[model samples]
Target: MEITNDLNSTFSPYSTTNVNATAAPNCTDWPHVPMTTLIPAIYSVICVLGIVANALAVCVLAHSSASRRTVANTFMLNLCVSDLLFLLSLPLWAVYYSQGYNWPFGNIACKVCGALHNLNLYASIFFITSMSADRYLAIVHPLQSQSARDPKRARLTCILVWVLAFACSVPTFYLRSTQHVEALGVEACAIHYTSDTWFYTLTWLKIILAFLLPLLVISCCYGAIGRHLLAGTGLLRIHPSTNAPSFKSQESCCSKPEKPLTPQQCVNKGSSSSGGRGGGRQLEGRGLERVLWTVAAVVVSFFCCWFPFHCVTFIDLLHGGDPMASCWAQWTIKNLTPLTLCLGFSNSAINPVLYCFIGNHFRGRLGGLCKGLCACLKARGEDHSHQRGSFSTRLSSFSRKLSDLKDLAIAEPSGSA
Candidate 1:
């Protein structure tokens, strides 16, 4: 992930040019052109777009009553906030790249921005993991999951997540600083780990902890959910007796009948049908649960986006000591690396869209909005005289009621005697 900037002036302490002929090799032709050109442009666009998208997601989730105040949604909100904070540093990066690695931003900004970026990385992964755990509990252990479903516990869990994310990000603060590369003239705010070993180890660790472990957890949870749903659906199909009459029809038939019937007909046969219909409804709910297993999809997307970037980084670390690599190989790696990393970074902005797709309430709200807009336009054209008067009054009342609701929703509920 580290791209070398303009570093022509200063001689390396280990350089062989002065004394030892083979002590250290020169890396003068390492494909800086593409790294200087394409990578920055791509990252700049991604950073801006990601910030805007994630910010909007936070606002919508915070404001929308349809978004249930669940532990998962709470984590998602925090995740969006983290992403926004991380993106705030991107403009500095854009500036740095535009000036060809000349960083005007001071040392403190470098450390802070670097830390924020890493914090978001850890926070985003952990939140996704938390969400998958929540899903697993809700699906696999519905009866026992009630206690864990409490919002208070969820809040505690989130607090812990933040703490852990911060702890994991502490290294970035220490490792990132303004390096005075004389060749570049201006200082380059870059991650300058003390040793290559430290960098490679941490990089691999991130791949394992943030990417691999979380992916496994999400995949397992969704897999279990899918199996449960399949089993339930199969059970419903096998048990025809459990799919009889609709609940409402059964209840009506159970009431006093005007017409006479046979002795056996005296029994409420409708009740049996109702019970079967109820079971079928439950099976349908299980099917919906299966569809909600998009956590796996999210994890897959994360891997797809990040794996290439990480692989390149690993390759670079292995051969970084070598100073005479082919220009084509270097150029190919440099160009492809940023594209992959940008894809990974895009995950922050995509989660809310996934929520809208998976959540029934969001879909319903969108449908309602479309319907309301059409109604309003139609009413505008026609003489809604009778409708207009009543609708206006009702709308005013609704507005006032909504104002009250907004207050209540924003305010923390107070305990009463």
Candidate 2:
């Protein structure tokens, strides 16, 4: 519940501007409001944007035609669902922060939201790993992997991922407790560890299960996939040759000989390799390269987003309140902690950007998917405008006829008189 629990500054904040000086343990020599407002703002924006974006991703991914379902798409759909569920839990925390770190919600809400916080972390990380693994199998073992790459297997894998993620989270649901802090005079929801033994146990569990294990899996997959992609000779030998990077650099990855091959020899080698593979293999290789590129980028982004937070958490636990630890280190964990949390939380929103906005094919499909939605609204607006225009035209026509009748009646009366 460290993730979902509210932290109150039991230490007094350094007064800034018109803010009141409250003697709280967590408040430092800095204004709490800036940190307060900033964190809530982050949560609020991520909640709203993450919901919309992940919803779009989930809807598009789920509606994939039966003919189009693949291992990657299944993992992506699972990732979208995980992030959407995580985003749903943020509003309550945002409200908690906005109300000055008070837990207005009861124990049940706290545990539910707290469980979701950790669940999002594990589930999103696992799903991304699942996606990378899917690409790995497709690229490295394309022939052998096909039998296992069906939608049924993908669904089963996703089910296991969800089960594993939530299985770890189940403990938090029972472990989290809310208590009134007399100093702050507010209820706070936090994990009440039975002992330092349990605290150490959970920390290790987090490192192994959430961070280290996932990183190892993704790294191995990408490494194998990268070796496979870069294994072949010239770039022109691959399908979609234009998009491929110049393999003149890749030739360096190979051992340099005292004498290089002549133009004819090089061309023959390229031609031989190209001709050896069928067109289907070339197409598959090209698809393999595309997935490798996207998933590699995703893997890097995932590391960059979550690493800082985990590093901080590791330090906080490893030191275990050592006297040798400097005030600066403590301050770092204090000040940067919330920011790092925000950064990690930002990952929930970023997958849709990576999967839908940045990847070319997915982006195009998402655009096509949303286009009809936008068009529906546009047509409705046009219909309403046309109706208003016709009503105005009729109203003016009626007014003009009435004026003409009045004029005729007056003229006729005068002429008769």
Candidate 3:
């Protein structure tokens, strides 16, 4: 591998040969906007907000009672932890970008940061897919027995996911190294693949493991959910019982339960009265209408956030021509890639908002958390005020005594002393 000292040469990301390890793309031809400034600023804001939100989520989810421990909650918790983990790496990247893509943190930091990004990318999407499947079981297969929805099984699944995600990220970590580009006068942290085979393999693996496969599973789960929901609105005839909407059966079946029910409880709730009759079918469909809408919002948001990033990855891989050979496209690539990656990084902050929107219980818990925080601050403020008042009173008294003593000494000391 040739280590070049010339920084003016373009760091061709799409080249068939190895990228110069020390320098990044020559952005002298880039658009007028300050990409180096804007990208890091945006990433810094995201890091702060994501860390705070995910930390709060961890607190809320962990303190939840065993009875409230639904499979959805388990997946949500895993998602938060992974998001928090990934967020921890962003500040380093933020600094790296702020310095015009020069990574001062050295090779170890570069490798760790890269590995964590991949870990969270894989883990977060997997958790979302798992969550969709959980909802599918709850809504679509309401009458069936499902062991996959058990809380214990969900825990095991989360462990397996984290372990797999971490293991899969090892190669990515090892491939990243920092080298000083004397021409650029900066050190760039980037993937320095020893062989082209590994580079191509990892790129495709990332698409499959992190993007395409997860999207496919989520789409199918939501598709079934959509079909189930359609039957309730009389668009489809899933059962003869659901044909005529009867209030008596529908009312009993669809009312939001006071307590969160497990998947088993949901099955029992659906089958206990009518034994899979018209009323049960009607209840199942209507019950998911609001939830489905929230889930739809979440799905849309997830895709919108991540789609640009995957597109950029595809471009970086497929557009093998000289980046600067085409003027407009080169400028576009120079300016476009960082924004796409920033958008992808924002997903860590979006999921909690979606969870709160989709979940009745989660919203309540978040509200309670907010209220408790306000009360704590209020109490602490009162204590601080009281202490200040006491100290001021003592200081005033001491000053008055000093003044009296000085006056007495002045009056008595003039002639007699």
Cα lDDT, all candidates: 0.58, 0.65, 0.67
Model 3 TM-score on a 0 to 1 scale: 0.74
Error of 3 at 213 (Å): 0.9
Q: List the residue pairs that clash in candidate 3.
A: 241-278
Local error of candidate 2 at residue 357 (angstroms)? 2.2
- Candidate 2: where are CA atoms >4 Å away? 1-34, 233-295, 321-326, 381-417
Worst 10 residues of 1 by lDDT: 12-21
lDDT of 1 by residue, 1-417 (tens): 233321320111101011101223334675454445665686678777787667666665576553256556676677778778877777776676667667787889878876887788788888877877776665466435656666678778889989998988887787677777654476766665555565666667677777778878877876776686667542122123333332222223345478644423322222111111111123356545445445456657667766776676566555553445555444444455555556677776676566443554444545566687899988776856867888999999999999999888767555331
Clashing pairs in 1: 9-183, 242-276, 245-273
Residue-wise C-alpha lDDT for candidate 2, range 1-417, written one tens digit per residue: 121122432111100001122322342564433565877899898888899989988777777566446667777788888898888988887777676657788989988887888888899999888877776665566445656766798889999999998998887777775667665676766666555565677667777888888999989987876677677631223433333222222233233487676532332222111111111133246655664566577778888888887787686676553434555555655566667778888898888887666554456567887897899999999999999999999999999999999999989978998
lDDT of 3 by residue, 1-417 (tens): 332222211222111223444333455654565766887799889998898888888888888776566677788889999999999988887787678768887788888888888899889999998888776776666435244467788889999999989988888777777766665687877766676577567767877888889888988887877777765652122342453332223333345478554543333333211111111334345455654576587678788888876775565455432333345444544556667777888999988777643455565677888899999999999999999998999999999999999998898878586
Candidate closer to the true structure by lDDT (higher is better), 1 or 3: 3
Best-first order by lDDT:
3, 2, 1
Q: Could you list the CA RMSD of all candidates, in the order they appear?
A: 15.8, 10.8, 8.1
